[model samples]
Target: MLTVQDHELVAAAIGEAETRTDGEISVVVAPESDSYADAVLHWALLVALLPLALFATFPDLLHWATAFVHEPWGDEAPPLRLIVLFLLFKTISAFLVAWAIFRLPRVRIAITPHETRTRRCRRRAIMVFQVGTERRTATRSGVLLYLSMAERHAEIVADELIQSKIGGEEWGEAMAALLAGIRAGQPGQGIADAVRLIGDVLATHFPYTGTDPNEMPDRLIQL
Candidate 1:
């Protein structure tokens, strides 16, 4: 969701922020934490199954409707095969309709709860940190700032060295600051601000060690 200028702005901010600290900060923004297809499919499946119960409970309506249409059914109840076929068709139709409707990102996001969104965001952030940022530096003071635009969620993950020095609650205000910018439709600015704020925090605990090497990238990662 960020433009080229925004990327440059954030990259510059990161470069500046890391200058006075031995800690490393990596930022990543994702379009979404997850596709949430499973949740949509679950909802769709439930909706699709509801019609089967309704049709089974009201078979007379079906029989009468079929007779009214002059269908070539025998003078007995609708056959089991017919009922199964009808329900199957209805279920398949319902599934297709639901899938089509829920394919919209907004609709999928709406069906996902805030708690789930937060959990998934955090999980993905941790995964990114583990795979990309954790222990990459000599001092192991790496930190990750992960943002999921679809969920409007932010997660900060710090390596063991940094985590041992700073409590998790201390990052709440940074997250809040980032989220405020995001809510204002200025995610790039929000990320830059968060980088600065986090840099300030890291600087406080791990002030510049003169010969410290730049061990990590300073560019914003978008996915």
Candidate 2:
């Protein structure tokens, strides 16, 4: 959810970063890393089970409660229709509540495990690198800086060339910086700063040669 000005600032940051190194850097921001449907379903199922358990475990109690309310008509065991109606009402109410809760973005995200979110972000980042950034240039020196808004996660993926020169963990600082920005509610500034940091690293290992060609697009990708 970046503004036009934020997009322009990010583009400029990428351009400025590329000026110092042959390594091509790309930034991608996604609304979410994954659909998290599994997590939502898990929560929904738990909620739905509550109604089933209550009906199954306390049938006698429920019947008594219903009979108590209908005492004016003479105390009788709850009718089959009444029991079925109560069960259905409870079941439907539980599901409806679950649906509403899961519809909240934060609630769905909270239901997802941290490890799952991290893995999804990393996998998505790698995919973006392979399909969008990798091997596009002469030296195969491409890096992707990716952010997942919902997960509040950031990842760095470098092509074979860059990986050969620097270990993946070397980009930890940049990733941390990006995540910090996100945690602080300043994603744009965080990404911009991370780009600058990554630029510095690339420049150190792959100085811009006069023959370096701009083989990849410089603008930030929004997905």
Candidate 3:
């Protein structure tokens, strides 16, 4: 979703933002937050069992199908073994078809529950914050801006010092600006705008001192 020029733009924005605040800022973008293989399996299994449920609820449907395969001159119903085998074949075929279709990234993401995507994206952003930005600054003023493209989700994680000083709602404007950029298909611009807003907030509470050192890389991290 980002090109070389976009990457450079985001990196430059972060650098510019940090120059005005003691807080450190980092941006991370991901193609997706999770593989969702389990979700795919669940959907495929449901599809495979649908026919069984239908036949169980309405046995007449099964009988109607069996009659088509039975000889018209024969008085006997279709063999039970044949019926079982046919059902097994159909169930397996349905499962394979569903599995194949859901394996695609776009299809899987489209069918995934909104709550699931939001939860996964949040979890990933937290993890990234913990590993890379949390407590890495001298004053615990590190911030991470994370974006998950497939889910169309964004998150901002602040270190202990920033969190103690800033309310979560204080970042609403920054979040809104970021999301607007994303919805407009300009992720780079969205991220840069968010960084600028975040920088203004940080500058208000933690204005840069001449002696403050650059504690983090300014480049945008892509995953």
Candidate 4:
């Protein structure tokens, strides 16, 4: 969610960064990497099983419920079919209620494991790099800087040539700077700072040659 001015600043940063290196750089920002609907369904299933678990743990509870359903004049307990239907109703209700609550964006994100979000964000970034940035440059030095707002995660995906020369740990400073800006509620600024740092790294390994062509767009992509 960047403003017009922020967009301009990021585009300028990309342009300035490219001036020093032949490497291609692309910036992509997304609201979220995944919907995580499967996680919500899993939680709902657990809630639905609670009734069955309680019934199994305390057989007397089921007996009491059956007795309550019987007629006052007749001392006989409810039929097996009636008891089964009641249990099914209770389980379904629990599942429906839990699903409604957990489907909320804030609640869903809070309950989701951080590791899951990170993994999904990384996977999405890699896919994006492959589709748009990978092997696009003459020297195959393209890099994709991706940020997921909902997960609060950032990823740096580089093409074959860049990855061969640069280790994952080498991007620590750029990642830290980008995350710090996000934590401070300035995603646009954070991305630009990361871009500059990345540019420095690329420039060191692949200096801009007069014959190098601009193979990628300089604008920031929002998704």
Candidate 5:
């Protein structure tokens, strides 16, 4: 059993580890520590902001080399209008991108055969995600999950948000299946096949293939 004391609850929606459900077990793929906000912010700047900056500047910046035919703003007044409009458009675009990314839901990214249910703890009615096989409503507050454990140092796994209403026997059976692959003897069905199977399960819950809702399971899934 994943105990709160054992694993550091980096972030949770309610009472630490207060959620569970049948067929649902939370497995931590990676926690907030590994995936800090800084990374996302940096990526946004690189992918969104920089291109928009160039777009905004490109209009007036052509003075050094004249290539464009029609200046959208027209030069009748002054270059200032074009620069200002460019900046305004870029600013709006960047703002929208930031808002969209911030408001988007988060889901588990790695392996372990379990599901997660998280809600933004304080704003329980707000953003939520059911990181599981089939989509279902979960706690509606922002959440990042992990399976917390302790041996010598605290070990936090990435999918703590799995909500399972498991019968005791089923839970036990599932755990046995998980451990069976790791046990030393004969290494059940070979390690590679076992790992591949686990990866397949994670893909079902939270696909890492692409963020597009239109994307179906990839035929040639490299991951």
Candidate 6:
């Protein structure tokens, strides 16, 4: 678990900015981040390492391939170094791992006032596959965004944070409407949009999301 404070990077960046400003300083703070652990590991790296581990643990496998290297220019063949083999395996594994991840069609979304970036992470069905055969599936990264104090700019960050554990798309759309409302100075509609989206999605089959603030079964809302 690599725990990083949201203020940690901001502080350092601000210090650098201030020093360069030559006594005039403006501090900037982006969104803060929370601690998270992940398991979407580099399996291809392991696949590459596995061979070298096996080689180190079993060197005789080299002999079979070395048989082809009996040319008179034997110095060119080198000593068939173990490190060379390890590095070769490492390099090949990197490409293969990237390729594998690229094929998995999953959706991930991150939104900010700036722009949104998405990626696909799961295999899609036939219809879905056609729409994203070239790699455009959306997946939930199980992420949540947290609000933080900004320094000078309305700074927002997407990486390195775990957001509120809510079903994002439904909630996110509602929230987008909410923010857009705020930007457009229609706070009432923003609130209403949020209420409607949250309420309807919750009341219906959107099982992943919670009930809307206004539609919370009265008793639940009261509580």
lDDT per residue for candidate 6 within 22-94, as digits (tens), equals 1111121112221111112334445556666665676676554444444444655456563476458555876
- How close is every model to the real structure, measured as TM-score? 0.91, 0.88, 0.93, 0.92, 0.27, 0.27
Candidates' RMSD to native: 2.2, 2.6, 2.3, 2.1, 17.4, 19.0
Number of the predicted model whose TM-score against the real structure is largest: 3
Model 1 misplaced regions, further than 4 Å: 57-59, 68-78
Cα distance off (Å), candidate 2, residue 165: 2.0
Instruction: List residue ranges in candidate 2 displaced over 4 A.
Output: 65-85
Q: Among all windows of ten consecutive residues in candidate 3, which has the lowest summed lDDT?
A: 69-78
Local distance difference test scores for all models: 0.87, 0.85, 0.91, 0.90, 0.31, 0.32
Q: Per-residue CA lDDT of candidate 2, range 63-134, in tens?
A: 776575566666354577666776677778888789789969998888888999999889998888788988
Residue lDDT tens for model 3, 1-223: 8889888988999999998999999999999999999899999999999989988999999988777766563756447866897689889999999999998999999889999999999999999999999989888989999999988899999998899999999889899999999999898999999999999999999999967799899999999
Model 5 residue 43 distance off true place after TM-score fit, in angstroms: 2.2
Could you tell me which 10 consecutive residues in candidate 6 have the lowest summed lDDT?
Answer: 214-223
**How close to the true structure is residue 43 of candidate 6, measured as C-alpha lDDT?**
40
What is the number of backbone collisions in each predicted candidate, taken in the order shown? 0, 0, 0, 0, 25, 15
Instruction: Give the per-residue lDDT digits (tens) of candidate 5, residues 155-207.
Output: 11222333232122323333344345335332222222323333334334433
The better candidate by TM-score, 1 or 2, is 1
Q: What TM-score would candidate 4 get against the native? A: 0.92
Worst 10 residues of 1 by lDDT: 65-74
Where in model 6 is the C-alpha error above 4 Å? 1-41, 69-75, 81-103, 106-223
